[model samples]
Target: MLIALISLFLAGSSGGSAAGSLTAAGVLALVVVFSAAATLAVSFLLSKTLLRGESSAFTLELPPYRVPRIGQVIVRSVLDRTLHVLGRAAAVAAPWGLAVYALANISAGGETLLSWFCSWLDPAARLIGLDGVILAAFVLGLPANELVIPIMLMAYTAGGCLTEISSYAALSEVLSGNGWTAMTAVSVVLFTLMHSPCSTTLLTIKKETGSIGWTAAAAVIPTAAGIGLLAVLNCIFG
Candidate 1:
């Protein structure tokens, strides 16, 4: 699970335009170090607490090595893995896409639903060094992390649909125009590393655990840690 979260963070950070800058690379390295340390610390704590159990060791029987079948392997890879993941992502993203469109289009008393929702979340978001739009983006992006920046851009521009920036320069301009700063970027990176898993991941966890309690824990633990850490950072630096 920690590996999955770190992978997501790496993907997000590396995809940004700022990633090309030396300063951004340094920040990424720092975050990577922090992630590694946190993973080890969390694992140790879990072993001593929630995961305490009698030690047991078991050996697995090795499967006999077999020659690879290229055609069969390709077929299984496409049909089983690629299609399965895409299907699940589409199932979640389709509805979310519609909802986002509506939220951006519909308005009451001169405020779009998206704006109103962001306003409502603004106070809490500010505590974590993020704006309401960014928070709303993260919440709406629960379906897929890839939607986050697009959703944020749409909200910022009051666009009726997701807005895609074609270049990193444009993306950086939009973010800065919306008041993003170095601290904001740091906060965002931290939250990206620590926030809850995407919807598909949560569903998979629920299915694998067969327990709502564990599934909720999987979502909540990292989020709570993120909130706590950000709160402290804001207090110290705000």
Candidate 2:
């Protein structure tokens, strides 16, 4: 699941003009390799420690292939998968949208609520090679990963609403103006790959595990790992 989510991010990041750049492709490929290596290392360590047990072999009977039924396939795909995912996303994103609007618009002590919150996070975020606005965006983006960049843009522009970048050049300009650098970009990419899963994924985890403790772990472990890695990177590069 984590791999799939990371792959989606990589694909989206590479789209448009950036997709044609060899450097961009190489960077994304390296990210994929690192993710795979980290996954394997963690799985091996878990198997030898916390998940230790006698190995067991299991097999499943394969179903015979059948000719495709286009109508039935489309119906099942739309109803069972597409609608289910959209419904879950909407359930989580709706309240988040309102909360984001209020945070960006409401004022306290002559500062917007969102600005105040970002200020509060600034010290810790800087320690990880990220600024307050970037960290705030990630937190606000918990409902959906797709919202992260737009939220950052909104906050950066003081737009008090989600803002879209019309081009990669515009995105680069905004980020540069906000003090982004090579190290900052590296840290952001690492964090994006390792942060807690989205709201829907957390809910699904809770449902499947039937344990709040495990659900919390699912959120915390990856975040902790990301923070630890970012700290190391900052120490080395910042």
Candidate 3:
């Protein structure tokens, strides 16, 4: 239930979508309706199919809704811990995000290096509907996937002038001006799905694996897959 709710909220928050313009309260209301419908369907299935025990066996306890004895304290505890962990992660990712902004914005030799890289990569990059520097920005964004689109947008826009993005429509216009098409959209969606988790996720991976080998592979394997898929698509469409 929790995961489903969070996923729906994130999907709703995707700024590129016209549907994302829906109010948060409106989205939550939809979520509640969906949840109730799903619950009813599951209950009916269990009663008609699973309860017979011909193919499978299971037991479910639907407890009556009731306030817990320590509901107030429990709610406070959950909120505090959730904020603490997420707050620490925000602190860790903040400077890295800022540094990314600088790298995308900074110019060398009176021209942004990112633009030059994109031009160089254009020969092959165009096949995948993206430029090289945009690809590189996405790679760097592995440390924090949340920033991928923003960095790529910045790299593509400002011609490396590094403008502050205050609106999604502005970002959309910039990409449209830069020759973006449907193919580019497909490649980016794939890349985002397969790229390494952000810096916080990397930290979690390291802690879980307790070995540099696994941690590195966690990053490399997915990246390899994404790039390989892009290359294959390029060859077919190039």
Candidate 4:
């Protein structure tokens, strides 16, 4: 949900379907297809090579086919997964959110901490068709995947805290005001897809693997892939 929403928002912000403007659906489609294919390829490669194991023979038992139970599915989705993930996410998001809010709001030398940090990151971020603000949002929003877009909006609008624009037009205006282009939209969508797991997922990975090194690798791998791909694409087309 977070990824889809952020992709859509960036697409629209790049002047999607506006008067005499091209929509970013083309770029979004490309990113989605490529990201999905890359993920599949990596998984296959890992299973076949680094993580290979001898095949085991086993007998399987089958249950009699029955009609699907809608209520049971709903209960399982809510109780078994949704709430559990949400609880963990909330635990990380709360304090992190407060820190983000404070950083964005507190002025330092006539600029907020976030603004200063973004300025410093601008040169590198531009290589990938994104600005420092977007990169900073991803970093600060690490506590929860869902916070990326909101934090971006807050940064772009210079708001004291995260704020949602009432309409797409307003969002487009703010983004355009910050020099957003179709290429920027494409890069953002790709990066969002490739970026590291949110804090909750990182915690889960650590718990499951019991290795900080592996957890760190899991985070770095996708981000590096995203950065390299974005740089190539931006050079070719931006």
Candidate 5:
């Protein structure tokens, strides 16, 4: 019930996709898997903290489940958080986008030094499960998460005009021009999906946690996790 309501709120507020077409079992399976993992993770951490390296116990709560106020929930999740994140994202993205354009365009000898730097990092980047172009994407994408895909597409162009990807064939050819393979695609997706959010998300974290430490942790933790995972994958599949 709560999940359905939350989904409805997200959809109504921001046109966020709701799981409308899924079979009942599929949705339940997703909720069950996600809930189990989150529950176990919290339980493990709390146990370690409370046990002092000894025995630990856990108690589960199952509320009788009463109807919740629609207005109250909408005010909290929809009107409040959606606006907070969106507003902060726009604030961060505007200046950050301009900065990124400057950094990416300001050139040496009629071409950007950025591509030169990407070349310099190529070997090291390859060893760590990426390429020179992917390294470039990472640097240029720091301003906002949304730019990652665009920068990556520009990298694929390799100093040429960016093209609209109309089909899988065109996508493959572009990637192929940059020496991309399945491994590269997999690694890129993994890294981008797991990496840090835009500056707005950072601000949101600060507000949500009311602590700079937790906000910083929120930023650093995912980054470290992504890098570590990529490093391991690179080592194994490299």
Candidate 6:
């Protein structure tokens, strides 16, 4: 979703499809790698500090190696793991998508609540090297990471649905018209890496910890890091 949204905007911008799509894909790759590393580091620190516990040791013995059963492996992989993950993802995504769609179309006092909310957040977002629409996308997309780009496109284009821009050139034009720059893309990639996990992940965390406080910490810690990191970068580079 992030790559699609960014690529669309870049394609619409000055360089055309080739440059814009390539840059967007490169940024997306960076974001994925950085996010994984950051998440691991944060998890380690949290485990040592806030989630600390007395250490325990266990010994393992290797079993005699044998060829695994192919049918059993397929069943376990597909039925036990893949289906479970898909179910959780679907549960989280559907409602949030509906809510975002409504927010885009629903209006109060001649303006959408989505636009009003974005405007309210614009200043703080700019401070962190992002704009209101990007921040709003993050917030509204909490339920699923995949929703972020759709939310951004809807917000930027003021479309009733999670509308597609059809071509990269059109996407670039929309993004340029909305004041996107390379810095904006960089900030977005960084923020996406450091921001809180999706709602499903949070739910899983809460389930494992069985504590709202820890779950809240899980959300806040990464967000704080992202904000601080981006603010520093923007100050130095902007």
Candidate 5 similarity to native, TM-score: 0.63
C-alpha lDDT of residue 179 in model 5: 76
What Cα-based lDDT does every candidate model obtain? 0.80, 0.82, 0.61, 0.79, 0.63, 0.81
Candidate 6, residues 109-173, lDDT tens digits: the string is: 99998999899999999898899999999999898777777788888888888766666557667
Compared with the true structure, model 6 gives a TM-score of 0.77
Model 1 / residue 2 / CA error / Å: 18
lDDT by residue (tens digit), candidate 3, 68-112: 669787787778867756765787667766766566567787666
Per-candidate total of colliding backbone pairs: 0, 0, 3, 0, 0, 2
TM-score of 2: 0.84
- Checking candidate 1 for backbone clashes, the offending pairs are none
Which candidate number would show the highest lDDT if scored against the true structure?
2
Better TM-score candidate (5, 6): 6
How do these models rank on lDDT, best leading? 2, 6, 1, 4, 5, 3
Assess candidate 3 and give its lDDT: 0.61
How much is 148 displaced in model 2, in angstroms? 0.8
> What is the total number of backbone clashes in candidate 1?
0
Q: Which candidate would rank higher by TM-score, 2 or 6?
A: 2
RMSD of 2: 4.9
Off by over 4 Å in 2: 1-20, 54-68
TM-score for candidate 1, please give it: 0.84
Model 6 clashing residue pairs (backbone): 12-172, 13-172
- lDDT per residue (tens digit) for residues 1-238 in model 2: 2232233333345534455354456667888899888778766876787669947467889899999899999999999988987888889899899999999999999989999988999999999989999899999999988888889888899888899977556777787788876677778888998889999999889878899998998888788888999999899889
lDDT tens readout by residue for model 1, 116-211: 999999999999999999899999999987788788899998888889977555766777788877678778878888889998888789878899
